[model samples]
Target: MSLKIEIHSFSYKKGGIPKDNSGNGGGFAFDCRGILNPGRVEEYKTQTGCDIGVQDYLETKTEMPKFLELVKSITSINIENYLDRGFENLQINFGCTGGQHRSVYAAEKTAEFIREKYPQATVFLQHDEQPQLNSSLINDR
Candidate 1:
């Protein structure tokens, strides 16, 4: 069976939490508001989490690394179990104030992590506030 993981980044103020279209009904939703927002800074205001400066600010100035670590740990267990059981879909959502910085970074990092650690799973990444950045990477293992 093929396993597909959907990772979404959304804005709490704009779009709110992303809906799971996987039909599984239950999944993980991570709130990124506690972390320091790079958007608050003048230079990072125009940049999304996809930019190097925003990523650097999130990594160095915020607790995002630790938060992502925890998220990785929790999600890893579920991913492994889902793969073992031959599950088809898993949805994970990350939400921040604007969905451009912290949530986007978190979702991107989590997709990367899942792709690296679970080569058997296909990953679909979406930035709800930035539809142009959406992509799907199918890992045919």
Candidate 2:
């Protein structure tokens, strides 16, 4: 059996949390609001996490790296277990104030991490606030 991981970036203020459409009840929801928000800055207000400026701000000025390291550590174990147990679906969510900067960056990085580490799992990435960036990555091992 193949494992399908659904990762979403959303806003706590706007959408609350993303639902687990996979019918698995739900999964991990990591709050990115604690890490410094780039949305508060004027220069980065217009840019989403997909942009370099916001990405830089989250990477350097904030504790996002450490936060993500923890998230990765927690998720990696579950991914391995899911794969081992032949699970069908897993959902991971990242939420921030605006769902633009911190959450987006974290979601993107987490998706990349999963793709690189668990090549056998299929990943569905969605930016709830920025739908244009939505994509599905199918990695068959």
Candidate 3:
């Protein structure tokens, strides 16, 4: 039995909290603004979170690992319960000023973590600003 998790990354300035059609109404939202931004650096300014250097900067310079740990703890509990109850959708959103760096990083990491931690679950990742890397572990709804 596979559970479904929908992870989204967006810019707060461009899109507000994504509307939940999963009957849950709302879901978790994490702001990436507090983390040190690679966007401010000249070399990393044009790069997205997918870049190795940007990912390294976030991992080495910011508290992203600790933050993801907290996220994992919360989502693990919720995902287990959701699976038990046969729930279909769990939405987790990450937001930042530009949605290109910090939020994108967080969302990608979270999706990867969820897929790794819950192999039976289906994870869909959507990046609003960078749709090129957007992917789905399951077919579109």
For 23-109, candidate 3 gives per-residue lDDT tens digits of: 988789988888898999999999999899999999999998888888889888989998889888889999888899988998888
Off by over 4 Å in 3: 136-141
Ranking by TM-score: 2, 1, 3
- Taking the tens digit of each residue's C-alpha lDDT, what string does model 2 give over 1-141? 789998899999998899888888999999999999998999999899999999999899999999999999999999999999999999999999989899999999999899999888888888999987775534321
lDDT score of model 2?
A: 0.91
Which pairs of residues have clashing backbones in candidate 2?
A: none
RMSD of 3: 2.5
Worst 10 residues of 2 by lDDT: 132-141
lDDT of each: 0.90, 0.91, 0.85
Best by lDDT: 2
Global Cα lDDT for candidate 1: 0.90
| Model 1: residue 15 alpha-carbon error in angstroms | 1.4
Q: What is the TM-score of each candidate against the true structure?
A: 0.94, 0.94, 0.91
